[model samples]
Target: MAGRKKRAGNPSPGPSGGPGAPSPTLLVRGGWILSMAPGGFQGHGDILVREGRIQEIGPDLPRPPGASLLDASGAAVLPGLVQAHLHLCQTLFRGLAEEMELLPWLQTRILPLEAAHDEKSIAASARLALTELLLSGTTAVQTMETVHHTQVVLEVLEEAGVTAVTGGCLIDQGEGTPPSMILPAGRALEAQLSLAREWNGKRSGRVEAALCPRFALSCSEGLLRECAAASREKGLRLHTHAAENKEEIRKVREITGLSDIAFLDGAGILGPATSLAHCVHVSPEDRARLRDRGVHVVTCPSANLKLASGIAPAAEYLDQGINLALGADGAPCNNRLDPWRETRLLSLLQKVLAGPAALPPGKALETATLGGARALGREKEIGALEKGKRADMVVVDLEAPWLGPGGSPETRLVFAAGPAEVRHLVLGGKTVVRDGKFLLWDPAEAAARAREELKKLLSRAKLPS
Candidate 1:
C-alpha cells in the first residue's frame, strides 16, 4: 500500500453522486477502514482522495465541494501488499527445478531456462506473472530482474500501474548456464550503475532501482565491492540472495573461507540498506550481527518449500528485532505471488518451526505491508495508512461467503480471504481494479496470450502441464 492517510475519525461523505460514487477520481466513505498501523487494523472512518493522493481521512466532515463519495459500508481497507523479493521473468518455469537442489537447479534447470529466453518469451512471461501478482493483491514488488529485461520489466510495471524497485543483474565470473546475450560482468556493472542513476527514484518515489548481484558464488569480491560502492555512492539499495542452501555456504567457504553472512558483512553490503532473501542457514551469531548492522531479511516460505530448502528461522529473527519481510521469489519457484497466500504460509511455517502460536495474524499482516515497505526502503511512502502516503489500497468485501461467517474482519481477512473477495482496488488514487475486474488492461486477452506462449515453451521442453 503506497498512500493511505488517516485522520483520527471518519470524514463526512463528500458530495454524493446521487448515492453512487463518480468515475475517475472521488472520495470513499462508509467503509470500515483498516489503517494497518502499530495499533492493529482500525478504521470506521472515511478516506478522501483527490488527484490520486490521500487528501484527508477521519470521522465525519464536510466532503470536498465536487468529490463524489462511494460507500464502503461493508468493506475493509488495507495498504496494498508489497512483494519484497520478486522475479517475474523467471515465472512459468515452475517445477523446472523441482528435482534439483538450489545449486544444481541454477546450473541445470533454472539457469538453462532463463538462458533460453528471448524478449517475446520473457516479456510475455513477465506479464503473466505480474498479472497473477496483481490479482493476488500484490501492489508492489522489489523485482530481481535479469540484466537485459530490467527496463522492459519496469515498463510492464509502469503500464500495469504497479509500484516497485526494479533491478538488473550483476554478475562477475558468472557460474552455471546463462544466455549468450547475458551482459558481460564488467559491462553489466557499468550499465547497472548507470541504470540506478536513471530509475532508482520514479513514480513520485514509488519505483526504485536496486543493485542486485546474482549471488556470492558468481559475484567476485571486486564485483561485490563495486556493487556496495555503487549502491552507497549512487544511493541505490542492495538486494541479494544469501545462505539458502548447504552448497551455497560451502561455495562461499571455498571462495572466501567465510560463511555467507560473514562474507556479505565483510563486503560492507550487509546493513540497513541491504535486503537479503532466504537466510535459512544463518547462525545465532549471524542473527545478532544482522540485528546489530540493521540488515533486512526476506523470508520466502513458498520457494523454500518447493525447492526443499529449509525454513527460515523467521520467528527467531523477529524476536531479535531484525526487520523481516515476505517475498514471492519468482513464479517459477513459488508458482504464484499472492501476498495473503504467502502470509498464511509464512505464519503456518513459522508456527511449525517455533510453536503453534509462533506467529499471530496482526504480525503476519505487517510483513506484507509495513515490513515490506521497510524492506524496499520506502517506509515513508507505502506500508501503512497515513497522510502524505500513496493512495494504494485494496478493499475487501466482507459480505462475501468466504467472509460472511467472519467473527473478526481483519483476522478473517488474513486467514480466510483470497482472490475471490477483493471487490475493489485503488492505486495512486486510480481504480486499477474494481468489482474483481481490472480497469487498466484486458486481463482476459493477457491470459489467453500467456496460455499460448506457455504451450510453446512447454512443447519445446516436452514438459507436461
Candidate 2:
C-alpha cells in the first residue's frame, strides 16, 4: 500500500490476481535498466512484460494494450538479487545464538532448535524468511532446510511466490550429532529423491529441488556417494557446506584422509552442478581442483565474520576462474537475510583481502545476480533483464542521501542502497511486492506468528525464549 504508485490507466491483474484481477501486461516505464547481461543497461528505458517473460526493452516503448503501467521514475531497475546459499529454517533463531563458533553454535543452539521444529514451526520460519527476502529485493534463493518437515518449507515457498532451489539437509551418522538429526543414509536419499520427484520443477518452473548433505564431517562416505549418484541420476544440483571452519576442516581431513574438496571430489560430488557453501579454509590445491572441476563457491561473508570463521579467499577464488555467488547464510549466523548487506560486506571484505580494485561495484552486483543464477544452473533464465528472460527484478529509489549524486547506478546499488530503498519487486512478471509491501498478507501478522512459534519452539527445546 505504501509503494504502489497511482497511475491513470486501470490495470487488470493476471493469474494470481483475485477478485478484480489486474492484467498480466506490466509496463515498467521511465527508469534506468541494468540488465546484468553484457551491454544490457539502458539509461532511460521502458520494459514490457507479458506471461512472466520480458517481451521488450528499449527507449520510448509504447504501452501495450490493457497493460498495467508502473512508473519507475527516479529508480534503478535491475535483476532481483539471487542468493545461492541460505537457511530458511533458521530464520526464527536470529538472535537466539550469539558469540559462538560454528560447531558450538550448531551443536548447542541451532541443532536443538532444528530438532524441535514441528511442521507449524518450520512453516512459520519459512514464511518469515520469505517475507524478509522478498521485501529486500531477493527474488530467488537456494535454501538448505533441516531434516524433517521439508515439505512444509516448500509449501511456504510456493505460496509466497518466490523462486527457489531447495532441499532437506541430510545427517545420517549419529556420532556427536543430535539423535533427532539422524536418519538412515538410504532413507535420507529416498526422502530427497521423493521430494525431487514432487518439486524439482514445480510452480511453472519457478521451484526446483536439490540434494543437500549437512557437511563432510557430519555425513558418512556412503551418504555422500548416494547424494552424488542421486544428483546425477535426477539431474539435480547438490548444495552443501564445505571447509567453513578450521576445526571442521581438520575433522574431515582426519576422517577421509583427504581435504574436504578432495574428499568431495572423490565422492563424485564436485562439479558444475554442485554449489559448495563457504570454502573459507580451502587449500591451494582446492582452488585448482575447484576451477578444473567447475564447482561454484557460495560465500556468506556476514555469517563467516560473525562466527569468527576466517574470511573466505573470495578474491583468490575469482582470480582462479571459479564461479562465485553470494549468500546471507542463516538468520542465526547472519542475523539478517538482507542481500544488500551481504553485497556490501562481500565488497568490503574483498577490498581488505586484496586491494581497492579487488571487488568492484559492478563485479559485486554480478555475483549477486548473474553469478547466482550460474551457481544454480539457471544462467539463461532469471538472472538478467533481457528480452527473453523471466521478469524477476527490483526497483530501487535513488533519492536517498547515502546514494550521493548517483552517477553510476551499479555503484550506488552495491554500496549505498539497501532494503529500505526498494520501491518494488517483480517475480516472474507478478507484482509479489508492491510499493514496499507484500501483497499477499500482512507482514505484521506474519511477524507475530513467527514470534509465537519461536516461543513455543524454545519452550519445547527446554530453552529460554
Model 2 clash count equals: 7
TM-score of 2: 0.95
lDDT of 1 by residue, 294-356 (tens): 999999998888788889988888999999999989876777777778888888898888998
- Output candidate 1 Cα RMSD: 5.1
Residue-level error in angstroms, candidate 1, position 221: 1.2
**TM-scores, each model vs. reference:** 0.89, 0.95
lDDT of 2 by residue, 127-150 (tens): 989889998999889989999999
Compared with the true structure, the alpha-carbon lDDT of candidate 2 equals 0.86
Best by TM-score: 2
lDDT of 1: 0.76
Best by lDDT: 2
Lowest-lDDT window of 10 residues in candidate 1? Answer: 1-10
